[model samples]
Target: MPMEKTEKTLLSKKELLEIFVNHRVDSPFPGDWESVFKGLGYEFWALRELEPTDSFKNIDWKAKARTGKFFVRDFLAESYFNVMILYDVSRSVQFGRKELLQAHIAVSLAYSAIASNDGCGLILFADDIVKYIPPRMGRTHFMEILDAIVHAEPVRCGGTSLGPALTKLLNEVPESLTFILSDFLYPLDFGYTFHHAAQGSTKHEVKALQVLEECEIALPPGTKGILPLYDYESGRTVSLDLTKWQAFNDTMSRQREGTRTLLGRAGIDLLTVSPADDFGRKINSFMRRPPSTY
Candidate 1:
């Protein structure tokens, strides 16, 4: 018998989109999926009472038959879309094995947004706002945003804060789709800040992409040794005994649950992906899916 060898080829943007369209989640989050991925063109409005000037092509005959009333489909022409990408460049992101993965995810989404004729913006933040590239349409602007994020320097700070950066975004950009990408390992009080940020967005939808390392998610069951962990953001060093390590893992578990709860309550759609998962598929799952109305 002969041996078989396989070569892996890189997937193009078109191929990635095909995968998304061909395969859908079991139960998609209820949202306006068509408007989110289709970019600028026309949006389907609710079926309403037919007007004298309404075209026959736009008429919803099924609705007319079912409800026993004349109704016509309405469409609103949308010129363009503004997609704001908020990526965390705190030192903590630079510490793990998946250091560059976060940027890759951000870059992918940014590419998709721009390719779809939407204005893509970049906001690199840590404890404070590091850099802000206002949303602009075109390949050149998207490339500039990508370059800034890929070459960004990690900040040395005590912790990550979304309040100041989000507050700034709320004040500057209006009616944009905001994407916040981070590991989200922050202090307890930061939750309040998150709630405040989400609450303040009146006309925008917030999509959260949480990047986490495998170890951060959970430890092996047999792990029973002392461990040395470093806080990259604060430049602090700490030694943990076996008991303390378990407690730390417990705290991380609780934090994950708390984060899910907080974001859910704020009506934010969260997609948690890890380095171990298929990056393209996971990203497509998040970006291409319908927004959650829950």
Candidate 2:
């Protein structure tokens, strides 16, 4: 039997959505949310919330006894922080104008979060911070987030610069459950940014949900022509020999692999999402990976 890898068959949005709705992650992450998130694999997520007492922060309301030492309390029977998703609306992610798909995934995350009684929000970025939706736990709130994403205009000013945005978003989410949905194909120093977020984190568990496309992972078998590629950021156009398609493919593969490795090292959960299959199933599967031992 052949491996059932998800392939991009000739299916319209409606057709693929039908398959997704019929199968895939069963949650209140909204109908379209599941489909979009499946394309990015940011469907289900939970976080260990740190309350005022459990956060190891020293607070002396009375200011008496001169006890100025931080204390680390136990769970104290507190509630868990649900989910929040940060979609990558950056330029590099717009390859073939697919960032629109990522936008849909962001909405799905919001719906899922609200459905789970968790707070959901958005962090849209391109080169710099574009928008930030504060996490709120409510069905209606999730709907608003979805509406915002759906009606968003494309950021014609393209290119991805993840480091700055990651740093800012980490601050916003604090220690909440953050799922970064992005292609992250930028030539920036994201390692330091992620490292800082991890080391300086005081409130949330962050996960890296990488959205990948089939065409990006492997190129079609065509080589032997002039290929002109334009940089969305610099507006610089460069022409390359199509004969080097094999090398180009290899480079892309390496870049993606390297990103996963770097994210893993930063204590971030890495889930691969594809644009070629039932996004809901893929998202549900990825979120539920490495079965819990508890």
Candidate 3:
């Protein structure tokens, strides 16, 4: 499929808002959004007279002042879940139209979550965590996330450090339906990190969306001679023999399969998306599918 010309880069706020509106009117997922998060978290239930065993932290100070009685807030386990987007702003993702694709996917999911009254958060990272917005539910919060994504630029020097980013998320954030969006072009081995994060005390539901350009997967047809490729993160260039295009394709294919296998074993679903694909619909389909088990 041909790429949409307008989507070759991140869209403006107006464009993003339009997409959000459309998604609310015509959601692609099948059942109610609440069903997607069954058995996940809790929501506020009610307030009742404070019991002797109730902690002082739960006491409603305002209620005590108003009615001259102690009351404590209560919660119920429910369908609420945090939707966290961990985006890679590393130089590698600066490749042809990858960031644009990331923005589309992130915006769609954030809007969907907020529309369903679920909390949505964002973490932008490269060599480390660049920015983080804790999961929150509101139009203002969604706009903050949208602003961060639209203005996000790739880090100028360092390669991706997904290990630290994942570590931070696992340690700090609550259990969430987390989505990692990146090109997965870094050389780091983060398989163990992913495994630990998925199976940690929090038991986060992790998913990954690998954004890539079509040419990155395979060289153009009828390519010949030496092709010079530049490494964005390293500021280095390497010459490749086009005669070895098939070898390059084989290596890339293996790398992709290896990633899928590793994340699958960690119980994380992996979806590879390209600028030419219908990413919104693809993301909806991916979300509908259950996470893979080891």
Candidate 4:
């Protein structure tokens, strides 16, 4: 169920497991998710940790950890991967291009992670993490997660509040093999919270990757006259004069620079991708050579 409409389930653990597993085995990924990944890489999955509920009484929502070995014949290499994905459910993610890419890139990457035998899970966050799914092996777990992610719903409307979200991840995420997927609008204290979380427990293992949209950063010329933009969730609209494109461009540049600077100071492994860009290649290129793994 989407966070916007988290549904109440009415099934037993055995029933849920049976259905989840059968779905995976029958629906083997359409793409050869394993081929793209090279050598051994850590896969990160953000999981929800919650009490047993009616819908999924059998579903285990904890940050469980595991290690596995795999060998790629073509690469003539064997390595280990610990991978997880942390996604922001903030209203900011509800915006333009960046939002679409999140659905495409993040979801695809998670599949690759599972194929690599790397533990993968999901992190659903707003002002705070709503749930944590512990990373584990098996096709059933992976497919179930992929389904949930593909169906994530919008939460409450609020200006990209990530401090609480990061805090939740900090408290629960098992390791650094985690890959953060967000626009990272860069709010105050949010950076500090993320930095502290990165420094806490397993330091330097967590990596921050930014997903952005092209239009937000730059605009085409002749997009003249007055324009208005509205928040997807809040429905708040702001008017802008087309003649100010140049100024808007300049200001956006400054914002980008500032975001990069702050992220650098925080020592976060930073990556920004646009929706127009080749979503898969960008992520594969960076992860093809992870700095380290557990």
Candidate 5:
């Protein structure tokens, strides 16, 4: 069923803190968050036969003495990296309880990254970049991010300018694990832009969280006759025939599948979610699972 429009308001500090606490309790992420996310760092990788070029400093003396063969301990490079969150504040996202859900997801991710001792940054965008915060760590930085999410408002005009935002991220932001949260209702060459972002000198580990309303996916089960559907981004209303709801669902499904395919080809992950989903669990699973598993 189509949900009633929700009131737009700022989330109080108490509410935000409650959400964070709930997420912490529900999340499956371990205390050593870095262990789950493998990357270059001081973390021990493995032991392998030592080669002529291998540094003697890394030699495993015990292993060599036991096996009577030269072996060296391999360590992963520094795994510390920033987590950049690109949030869409376009008008379309304000539909139903989407913005609220988005807030939860964003806040949870920010807190998780910070808890993992990683720097977290944010970029809020509508037709263009509305605000940008460089990645930083510490409790104070987390508060700043929480404050931004709490006060975030959807832009009253213009469509999503995802392309422009990606360009800015590529040009300015350092390589990081980037998550783009949006409804993805706008028409843009997602393949080209995402592929570009996932490759080259500024390559980043990009992922997407597509937040959508149930009604946007399909009309109510008993829907009938013509309905006036409003385009929030454009501030226009168009009549939609309820009889063609099946067709509408098919079209929306195809669009979503197309997006998923495009992003997957670029080695990026995409997770579609609704306002009622368990965001903390979903996020934990998404982070832990491989892209192919999606």
Candidate 6:
């Protein structure tokens, strides 16, 4: 049965902001906060003796209590991170009504980063880039990001080229951390793109959020139907023969594996989310997971 869309099923921007803030503050992060920041290229400096006029918040109470010495924590000058959200607005993303969830995830991440004082940017694309918002900080900039996602529409082209968009990103924001949200149904060679982005002077951190439907994996038992299967982008349609469904299933499996292999080889983190899952909790855990060398 197809899931029914509801007001409660989709979150408002206010709710999304609340969830992200709560997760960052109340939920347990996979590792220490300092470690998480460091993994994202944040710099940390050593602690020094506390000055008499230093704020109490900066003083080390334990060190002061242990000895007669007052200690204060010091840190390197922190710069706002360039967080770019690369969303694939291709027609395939609408499958199983997953577009709302995708949008929610994208907005949630962008909001969370902006709340952390990071400059957030957005790129919505299909065959070509539809919209590009350069990274910036402030409430007005964050609201523009929300508006961009809410008003986005996919292009009617028959193909998607992630390479070109990624190329543009490197040229524009070389030291960015890019989050790519897509179904990755394109036939183009993205492995090469991933390889290039992960290497050289303009190296940027890439993470993938794959949106998929359950029907793509398995059909219900005793299912009897002849459905018109269509590739929204390519405009290719075929009759799905229930008796020969294994062929279709095999193809989807291969595509999933191929996407995973390409990202894994490039040391990119990939997280798959389905509409049926608890999206907020699932995404929070993913964002909070301990970073690996991969």
Best by TM-score: 3
- The residue-level lDDT of candidate 5 at 196 comes to 51
lDDT of 6 by residue, 237-278 (tens): 988877666777777888887877777676666777776766
lDDT of candidate 4 over 1-294, digit per residue (tens): 111100122222344335545664432232234533443334432233332221243233332323122222123123544466777766677666455556555555566667666767777776667667777766777767766665676677555565665565556654546667888775635654235445656542455677766667777776788888877657789998878888888887788777766665765556677756554545545544434211
lDDT of all predictions, in order shown? 0.66, 0.57, 0.74, 0.57, 0.71, 0.67
User: On a 0 to 100 scale, what is the lDDT of residue 97 in model 1?
Assistant: 39
Please give the ranking of all candidate structures by TM-score, highest first, separated by commas. 3, 5, 6, 1, 4, 2
Model 5 scores a C-alpha lDDT of 0.71
Each model's TM-score, in the order given? Answer: 0.68, 0.65, 0.73, 0.67, 0.72, 0.71
In model 1, the Cα lDDT at residue 158 comes to 79
lDDT accuracy of residue 140 in candidate 5? 74
Maximum-lDDT candidate = 3
RMSD of each: 10.3, 11.9, 13.2, 13.7, 9.3, 9.9
In Å, residue 251's CA in model 5 sits off its true spot by 1.2
Q: After superposition, how far is residue 26 of candidate 1 from its true place, in Å?
A: 31
TM-score, candidate number 5: 0.72
List model 3 lDDT by residue over 1-294, tens digit each.
122323444565457666654665454222133333432345666788876545677688999999999987765435567889999988888787888778777877787788778889999999988998999998789878988988787888566777777777877776788889998876645654345444656657788899999877887666789878889988999999988788888888999888887778767778898877766556545654534556
Worst 10 residues of 5 by lDDT: 1-10
TM for candidate 4 is 0.67
- Candidate 1 lDDT over residue span 1-294, tens digit each: 011111122233344344434665232211113334442236776787866544567679899889999987655436576788888888898766344666656666676666667788888888889999998887678668767865688888878988776776777787577888888778423332223356564555677788888778877665677778888976778876655556768987889878876776665667776667665555544543444443
Instruction: Assess candidate 1 and give its lDDT.
Output: 0.66
